[model samples]
Target: MARNFIRETLAKENETFLRRMEIPNKDSWSPENGPTSVRRHPFCSSLKMFLVALSFAYFSKALSGSYMKSTITQLERRFDIPSYLIGVIDGSFEIGNLLVIAFVSYFGAKLHRPKIIALGCLLMSLGTFLIALPHFIIGRYKFETSVRSSANSTNNLTLCPTSVLVGNHSSTLSSTGCENESRLSMWIYVLLGNILRGIGETPVQPLGISYIDDHALEDNAAFYIGCVQTISVIGPVFGYLLGSLCAKIYVDIGFVNMESISITPGDARWVGAWWLGYLIAGLITLISAVPFWFFPKSLPVPEGRLAKCSPERTSFIKDSPGLDHKYQADEQFSFVRLAKEFLPTLRSLLGNPVYVLYLCVTVIQFNSLIGMVTYKPKYIEQHYGQSASKANFLMGVINIPAVALGMFSGGVLMKKLKLSIMGAAKFALGTSLLGYFLSLFFFAMGCENAKVAGITVSYEGMESLSHQNSTLFVKCNAHCECSKTEWDPVCGENGLTYVSPCLAGCRMSRGSGVDTVFEQCNCVAGGNLTAYVGHCRHRESCQRVFPYFLALCVITSFIISLGGTPGYMLLIRCIRPQLKSLALGFHTLTTRTLAGIPAPIYFGAIIDTACLKWGHKKCGGKGACRIYNTTAYRIAYLGLTLGLRTASFFLCALGLVVLQRHIKRQENGTLSNGNTGHTVAELQALRKEETHNSHSDQSPRTSDYDPERETRL
Candidate 1:
């Protein structure tokens, strides 16, 4: 009886092991074997469905982020703050991103990622709405002016040329007398709202990309990433366009007459309808969240797809379906285990010299990108003398679309050529070098600076400038009661921008608001007396350079972005496959922490040093800059951008060399097997399986990083 019982126990134990281990269907799957049935998960998505959902989510988040980027200048004008202050506000988003990204990227894999992502989307939408909240809460905007158009009309009437003038106006200077008014400083609301927006944006990329990487077919991964990136980049096109449209709308909108606004969008003092874009972006983000909450935490493996790992090693591969058990089974999470693994995993990643170098290259590159983008619009307005509206329109219509095309083409090239990791690195390096070479030409495309009296040119309008820094007062207008801090600019017919009607020695003026024409301006040269209420537009030479600059911008953007996909793939494939989410997270965290938060601030500070004229706050102290020394501004902005890019090229070269050597070593050891040369051990098994299955009914698609699909050298 005892012998029989022991034999029965041994038989039951064998049955259990066979059930758990995916005992290979020798008849169904072997090198010489015939076609066999394969199991698929019920909850798995079709490629089409995954693309649609992923694209929409990326578009929504990018739209909101880009909108904020487009409106920085507007915010500075509206809040009466310096460029550096606005930079701090812009960097708030990076702060929020830094706080939660590491934890979320590390822990999200074990949780219900879809729900977490939905929650993040909801927060982002809420934050956007809150950013717009200040517009409604604050009182009607009360701009300071040298001409009080509301109550003093008689002085203006006396100096009027009835032929050019129509409305009753005023010339008596007025101040809002906002003495020490701390209670109504609503800029704080805007700052907090932006911070909230930053927090909300944390999960969109790290979680979303990881989710796609986890479930999408290995062959389609890079292309899908490119598609998602393309859509996200395209989102900024509409964002800049939206910024352009809203800038034309008066900041007060329905509350004030458009005709009554003394400043046009081209005016330095002008504040665009910044809040409107935020509102629209918020609504879109809200809509983006709805699809995520319903998406399953994980998808089932697709049918007839060859598992990368063997059936016997199913337990070793979390993502592979080597066994028949449902994906939902064996669900578990432990914070203790997460804590235990964190340091060891982190150490392992840092030990990889290739990843560290890639991280440095990306960080430097991002710093240049963020700083350049942050200041590009301002540079255009100050250097090219384009309006904020025109600058945004050019960015939207030209620059962003070029980036989308470049990104998509990169993906297509990778797919068509089936580039190995070494090949992709080489491609990325070549494009980066070419792009850097093209960008240096921008230094030659400089436009003549604005001909402002006492700054770029002498008040007497001499071509020879004695000093960059000059006093606002000259003999002709020195006796007039002028405030050096005031920024109520007027354009004389002689093509000089006056500080104000007061500084112009115009004791009288005609018309109201933008129509307010200062007549008999005492400071005019060549006896030209009339001046309009706006800065003199830049010289005609500037108009010709504008198109050339746009062309260069388009070409440069395309070439640089062409390398974006290949570079991203290099970052992914260098690390162990299991740490993809963590690798991505750490990279984001490191870049954002070291680069994103500081780049804008330092750029703004350097730009601030080039300020020629500054506006004043009614309460006290310096506010926004009225004018910049275009020469200094151009040199500082473009020089910094190009220098960073040049430095990145060196790093890129070194990284490529390191990667090539590493691959060569792996190849010598017979470890590297994939077309992309990923050194994972499972590649050989999968490759062996695929080679023998060529005679089967269905075959897998050829892609970049696998052995069965060798790349064309």
Candidate 2:
């Protein structure tokens, strides 16, 4: 009976609060009184239309990000660069975001949001197209090979000196300056393109979310966002699938005689059609941009819902002179005004201890997340001995889908439970800890290192090789005319890996290119003195472990992503409603700068240290690291990730305690001031109005906690 009385009292309080906060329909909202556009199309005002455009925007950006992850190794091989260089390229996007995100997040509210978003999308499309430009302009992709054949594989005629002995077409050999090339850093285009993409993506999240929150039903906001996220998740799946398809095709398939290529997709030095996925993704991005151009600055709010905020007063703002610097709705755009007030507002926000604690957790979590994601596919390929094509396919079809489902499920749980700020924080904390715990098993799930001559195993297979033993000189190949730096791997029939025929002490080689085989290979054991072209296949033990690894990945992805939505919503609830945009923008800016930008570079650099065999560049500098010490790679990759996240959890626990205290103080302050009502800003007021709905919908349960007793505002 006491519980029932308390519930009734809070219900009455909430009902009274909602009635006072409600806006007058005639005075606050109407298309007739709003800012008139050049073309006031009805579709621009439709919430459904804007939602569609926003969803597409989300899809396009995610597709590009995930696709880049899938193609990291391919890009490394194609550019003849090391892992660290690719990490730099990955970090370039964050650099672009850091440049324009603050201004866009703050000032963009004063402008046409949809049109600005459309412009950003166009920039992304152009950037995506630009990333593929190197492939077209770089001439034919000449993968490094050391072979000599008399006839072509595709033409049965000598096409080039390196052609295989089975072809249908023949072209005379033509040598270019490629052999003596020096300025091999053609990856600059991909970097700039990624930077443009980052700049384009900057406005989408803050602006788009703010816009939706402005006009959508307060109760449905989280659910709607969840739906959009679920749709957006589809992009990565397609991206990975697209990446997989492209990786199977040879880099210069149609342009060159593919039959004469000595390496398979399984070969460490192989470069796939990594550029093609970008072109297709860009085209999709261009299409996504089209719908946004037609959307208006603001849409008319539905009945019972509060009207949208005026453009002059942004949803996110910087307060100067005082904690509350109120702006008139008719104030003009002024750089002088914003410049004067920016720092004080920033300082005031940073002063919130709870927000600071949350920031610590986010920055640390993102560091781990970014580092793992940036090198995850490479980790799979190098550790599991999977091909690039297979790794991408698995990531796309299995891992990403799990994440998508988890994200959607998280949002649904929030809406269904109507979790308060405290509730959301607890839920996020639990899921994260659980996921981290489960991920601990990945360290144990390791594949044995590939057997490479002079690297992991001896050339004659008589003894094991150590890290100190790098030179491929044995009793059999000691007198062979071979350069230590020359690395064109060949698979010997004696189940041993050889550096090359020259290093294998082979006097003569039969056929050329793809059809090439070295006979009388002195390095091979007595039974069969023959060696085929390209790297040897992985052992059966490695292949058997792949299925279990993939299953674990799917489960881990789902559990980790389950926390994503709750964590996001918790962030929204923790900040002042008016400063939502600024808080989100600041969070993204700091996280991207501190974590996203540096994570990949450092992760790749560490992984680079584990390289057992480094591919050669055209000008003879260190190219891509072809083989990695699997044990070392695993330790570097997972250790850093797990360590960062584990440390972040301490912050998460602290943040939870801090949040509880903040809520208590905030409630006390509200009670002391007797401020039972929200201000007359439509969007902000509606959030308060929904407080009654959020509480009353809850079922009475015997518990240690009671939200009704604490909600003073």
Candidate 3:
């Protein structure tokens, strides 16, 4: 009887275990099953989606801009529009974006984020289509003109102006008139197109950032934002490539050669070729809209029930509620209130020494980068005598490695060193600035020495060396040694035929009584005037100027890149998870507001002024004129460098102070102090809890426990 009782009890225990297992745990299950699993995590998948969307939008926008960039100068020439005015027109898109971002960010928290993103995408597509209309008309006109020109040439005698006879009037009809009509149509279309593009792009910046903010965790917000920035950087490169390809196609199709019987100069051909590239760019923008349709319509958030009381009302409750309460409270927080709250938070942040210091550093770094982007090409073209396209290509190529290494190495170094996020930021900013400075130095040195000798010493000058000169010119030829007759015979006889006369003459004349003549020649070659005692004063000035300029470039690059890293890192690290997205949005907003709107236009004005003063003949005026003629660019660079440096200095100081203050506060036990060593572990635990709650659809009534206050002594 006892053995039978034991078996029945064991069976009852087994049944209880099976029943518990069979009951579904709703908390752990995702709302959407299958492929959506990959996208369920807001911390990862939503951020990735936002990045991809931004990448597409930015790429298309930049490409459209590139097309305009390549063609705008030609348009100015054809239509007699001021280049600066064209620049303003070009900047309209950025202006629109700025306005849109400000409005969206202010109101974004209240709106359905997916709907906002969709609206942005729709606008972008519509704008792209509108922008393309002008180019398309222009393209068609050119095509028609080419056909007509071919027909006219084939029947030259019958189509002659003096000839009264024509076999078929339709066949002999002038297509040039149609081409003109198309050109007129293009002018009208371009204005409407730009307006549409501006409107489309307006909501993009804020909406995209807000979406990411809505979805991503605070700790990882910076990383995701960085990814967004990385994707953004790619836009310009793609735009350039696409524009170039379009231009090439136009050239191949003979659309660029549809001119009257008058002989077209090579420069004119080049101008036409460039314009054709722009037209192609617009078409590409129009085509980019096709991809938007495939974008996911909406993203799912974590499932949870709303709290009984609003977050404002919950302030009456002294004790912190459970996870469920906090979740509901967060959900009920009004976006407007959040935006208003941001101002105070920002002000507090600004007031904090550490935060201020970081901000200063970041501003400097950003400004330096912007300055480099704006003027580096011009510097190369002017100081190095490189073509604009070549200069742009080189700048882009060099940056690929530099930026990649900077970002990756900066992150690694930060992690390895266990630097505070702010510290890591500062270090990165400093390093990048240093790198920029070095690059600038090299660039400047290259520019100065490019023509000093036959040998190319700088990137700008090195590029000037043709294949013909590379083989024919000896190393000694660079020092103008071939012109020194006195030591040429001796050097050549000694198997040092390429040696400079200054060196050989100095060595040979040293032993002889003819030192004075050789010394005079050497002085002349070195830019020293030994003719008079005081004349040597000018020599030092000449020798030092270029080196100083090069040094400035180094300093500027270093300061900018260095200062920028800290703020960028801070944005990644310190902000609360829920607030990080908004912080990042603000960061982007500031950058775009300050830099994006003015940079291109400012550079364009510089180019125009330079061209007008220097004469187009020397700087390819009939085409896009280079900004090499004036010191305005340098002045601008200097101003930016100084501003950034000042800001960095302040930010660094602020950060240090804030950090020190926080340390003091912790030591004094004025605030709840958690074990610093266990911060990471606690964060991980919190994340796990959040994950559990999200999947289970648990209520927000979980008890509130402060990890910092719960540590065992």
Candidate 4:
């Protein structure tokens, strides 16, 4: 009763507040008058569209990167699979993604974006469910013995120098051998699941961009795109945090100590509880799809026009004064057109030496950033001898701040320097590469010392005390030394032997020093010390690398964000009003398709190979393994850094050259591709008209078509 009364009172207060604010109730509103009258409601239709886009973005972010990391790590630990094979699995996600993107870009324009998004969401959920099923089966039976025996056999059965496990074990094992069955079956399922997810998620990228392009004005496109990308960053951050939290919870719950039915007392549990997190993520993804049913059916396409009035005046003229106009509506929204269109754009983009250079630089920068992000945690665990949870936490702690600062700085530099989109991208890429190098240096040093310090400090105090006590007695009491010969020290000593006391004291002091030095040196020499320090140092490096890496990621994102801005401005300042949407759409389709397809596979391959080599450190000869592991990681980092730097330089050069050309063309009062001055001026006039018409409720009539559109289309 009390709870109900409180709720009733709060509801009444809320109603009173709304009344005071003159908030219009949605039920009493009409759509024809627009959303202004019911300002409190905003545009439900647009809001729904935005939310749908957000959901897809979130899932894509989670599934593409963070999920890959989690799944690969799980596979490496549970199945003892080689890192190279794991790389293949990781790369497969991208392969699947690329193929799907191609197909979607061809067919998606005909399909409703909402339905496409929904389908993708469903498929992702299914994939996650299938991938996780085998674990459940294995967990249920508690089959400790069979798994242990098979693992032992596999360890004994080395097939090649690569340590690849490639036998048909299913034939030899009984149905009840759940451990082996689960291990083998789960991987197969996971691979299949990832492939399905890749295909499902493909349509999401293009469709999402289309949706944003459809609703947002051309001038604001880039800003909105940036907002989307910013949201994307959240997915990984959340995934990493959740994954780490789950791991900690598992450890705290003593899940790590539960022995397999057949293993030794200290054996780890076969089925980890951390998997629950994956299941939960899938469920959340599914739930996110619910709002798609309510998305608006269509949006008003934007039109271009020009005003005869001055900049401050609102009155407009229908056509440019004293100019023959030629313009037409060119819809490039069809899926078939997008697919067919991409090849030409891709060719053109590739042919542009500047663009090609930028692409290469971007790829390399992304590779290094991704490689470090994916493996830093594992590196910390292996090198610094830290737990997975602690390593991950340390990674988060270091990266969050570094990335935040890098992102802020990148934004500031772009704004202050008045960089064009490409210039900004180059600056971001270069800065990120520098960060990667600095992180690598710190990581290497930290790893070396962390191991040396942790172990030596732990053992040094006890050893030092032992030496001190031995030395103190030798210096203070001569009778104590005489007791060694006669048992009775005071009565049977025949007086204290002071003759050799000085020598004994000197020897003890020298011995103590030698012992301390030996212990310190010995601890440092063992590569295990590397493991402890490596974890923290690697984490710190990753954190340091985050901003630059984030900046690099956002560079492409920023380009995508600014998608409609250039074309819209070109239309308003120079192009036919009727061609605005069509031109903007064409540009958007070109850039997004080109950028999105290769990212998944390219990054996946780098991460996979790095992981494989990192895992191999566990198998090599004892003395050589740590060195091999450390060297392998160093090589990986070097590859990433060099690749990024090369890319950065290229992008910077290309952007500078292109912008210079664009500016020169503007100054000459001539159009590229040799259009006439009259035609160009008329086009610019139409764009001004379209911008004015867009802000008002007036609809554009079909009779406004001009001849220039025919030639362009």
Write one digit per residue (lDDT tens) for candidate 3, span 354-437: 444544455555555554455554454455443345444543444433554455555565667778754665575466446544
RMSD of each: 10.0, 10.6, 17.9, 17.9
Scored by lDDT, the top model is 2
Model 1, span 1-713: residue lDDT tens: 23554455554443333333333333334332212322433424544565677688788888888888888888888878888888888888888777777677677766887888888889889988988888887657766565545634645443312322222122212233453354666777777777877777777777787778766667777678868877887788888999889888878999886666788788887888889999999999898888887776666544333345445333323223333443224222235656777898899789888999999999999999999998888888878877788888888889889988898788789879899898888888888889888988888888766877776777777763534567678777755545567777888888898777766666577678877777777777744388888888858888888888899999989998888888888998888776787888789789989899999999899889888778877666788888887777888999889889889888887888899888777685564443555454346445654654563426444442343132100
What TM-score does structure 2 among the candidates reach? 0.80
Evaluate model 4: give its TM-score.
0.56
lDDT of predicted model 1: 0.74
Residue range with the least summed lDDT across 10 consecutive positions in model 2:
315-324
* Model 4 weakest 10-residue run by lDDT: 483-492
* True lDDT of residue 23, candidate 2: 25
TM-score for each model = 0.80, 0.80, 0.54, 0.56
Off by over 4 Å in 3: 1-83, 106-118, 128-199, 202-233, 244-253, 256-269, 272-350, 356-365, 439-566, 572-582, 606-609, 612-713
Task: Give the runs in model 4 whose Cα sits over 4 Å from its true position.
Answer: 1-64, 139-185, 216-227, 249-272, 299-346, 421-426, 429-433, 443-628, 638-710
lDDT of 4 at 274: 48
Which tens-of-lDDT digit does each residue in 488-514 have in candidate 4? 000001111111112111111111110
How close to the true structure is residue 275 of candidate 4, measured as C-alpha lDDT? 60
Q: RMSD to the native, candidate 4?
A: 17.9
**Poorly placed runs, candidate 2 (over 4 Å):** 1-45, 149-184, 213-224, 296-329, 333-341, 415-420, 663-713
Clashes (backbone N, CA, C under 3 Å), per candidate, total 0, 11, 33, 34
